[model samples]
Target: MKTTGKVWKYGDDVNTDVIFPGKYTYTIKDRAEMAKVALEDLDPEFTKSAKAGDIIVGGKNWGCGSSREQAVSCLKERGIGAIIAKGFARIYYRNCLNEGLPIIVSSEAVDAIEAGEEVTVDFDAGQIVTKKGTFPFPPYPEFVRGLIEDGGLIPHVKKSLGLS
Candidate 1:
C-alpha cells in the first residue's frame, strides 16, 4: 500500500470528453468499458495498459471540461494511484475530491518529473519525492483528505458516523 507508483505525463486542457466519450457514456455499463475510452485522444492504451498505483502527471489546466463524475470514476477504475498536475480545472478538482483521489497541483514537481519515474506521495504532509528532489505542494483540506483516505466523500461520511 505504501509502494511508489509509475508516472505517466500529459499536457494541458485534457477535457472530459477525452476521458469519457459522450457516446460510450450512455451505455452505463461497467467501469472497465468506460476506462477503455479514457484519455483516448492522448493515449488509447491508457485504460488497457495502466496498472494499479500507476501515477498520472500532467501540465497546467489538467482535467478541464465537463463536470462528469465519471471522469474521476474511470481513473479510479483504471487503478490510477494519484495525479500530480501543474493546475486543475475547478469542477474536475472538486470531482476528484469527492472521489477521494489525491490530485495535487505542483508545477515544480510536474516539470521535473517524467513518465515511468518512481516517486513517493505524502498526502498528509503534502510532500512529493522524486529522483532529483523533494517538494511540498498544497494539501487537501483536513476533512477532504480524510474523505480521500476513506475512498470518497460519500463512503467516508457513511463510515465516519457508522451509517454504512
Candidate 2:
C-alpha cells in the first residue's frame, strides 16, 4: 500500500482530547461531524485546511493521553492518509490499528519532515520518501495489513466470517 500527500506537522505529547476534544464527545455521534472538529483544539485551521489525503507527522509521544478511539476515527473520517510519529502511546497505537488508521513510528521522518512538504509512504517497503531523504521503518505484518485494508478489526472479522 502507498500513500502520498502534503504533511501536517505536530509537536510531541499530542493527546486524544486535542485530536478530538471532549467538548463534543457526547454531542457528536456522526463520523463526518466529528471530523469537522478534528484537531481544532490543537490547530484551529486543521479541519479547514487539511485535505483528504494529507499526512500527519508528529514528534515523540504522539497520542499520549486518553484512549478515546474518536481520536483515530476523526482523523480517518477526515480522510487522513497516515500518521507518522516519533513514538506513540501504547493504547493509542493499538487504537489506530484497530480502527484501520495507518500509523508509523519513525523519529527520523518526524524530525525531518516539515509541514506542507509532500511525502510518500510505501507500506509494502516500510519506507517514507521526501525531498530530505528516504527513511525506513518496519513493515506491518500481513494480518494487521489485512485488517487495515479491510477497514479495521470489525470489518476484517466480518469478512473472515463471510458476513461481508
Candidate 3:
C-alpha cells in the first residue's frame, strides 16, 4: 500500500489528551464530530486545515499517556493516513493498528520531515520518501499488512470468514 500526504509535525511526549481531549471521550460518539476536536488542545488549526491522507510526524514518545482509543480514532476520523514518529507508546501503537491507522517508527524520517512538506509512504517498499531523501523501515508482515488493508482487525476477520 502507498500513502501520500502533507505533514503535520509535532514534538516529543504528545499524550492522548492532546490528540483527543479526555473531556470529550464520553460525549462524542460520531466519527466526523470526533475529527472536529482532534488536536484542539495541542494544535487548534489542525482540525481546520487537515485534509484526508495528511500525515502526522512526531518526536519521541509520541502517543504517550493513556490507552484511549479515541486518540487514535480522532486522527483516523480526521483522515490522517499515517503517523511517523521516533517512538510510540505501546498501547497507542496497538490502537493505531487496531483502527487501521498506519504508525511508523523512524527517528531519521521524523527529523528530516518538516511541517507542510509533502511525503509519500510506500509501505510495500518500506520506504518514506521526502524531499530530503528516502528512509527505510522494516516492511510489515503480510498478515499485518492485510489487517491494515482490510481496515483493522474486525474487518479483516470478517473478510477472512467471508462475512463482509
Using lDDT, give the best candidate's number. Answer: 3
lDDT leaderboard ranking: 3, 2, 1
Query: Residue 34 deviation, candidate 3, in Å?
Result: 0.3
Tell me the TM-score of each prediction against the true structure.
0.89, 0.95, 0.94
Q: How would the candidate models be sorted by TM-score, starting from the highest?
A: 2, 3, 1
- Stretches of candidate 2 above 4 Å error? none
lDDT of each residue in 97-158, candidate 1, tens digit only:
88877788889999999787999887666789999799887766788767777888889879
Runs in model 1 lying further than 4 Å from the true structure? 1-3, 159-162
Candidate 3 lDDT over residue span 46-124, tens digit each: 9788999999999999989989999998899888889999999999988888899999999999989989999999988
Question: Model 2: clashing residue pairs?
Answer: none
**Model 3: how far residue 151 lies from native, Å:** 1.1
What Cα-based lDDT does every candidate model obtain? 0.81, 0.91, 0.92
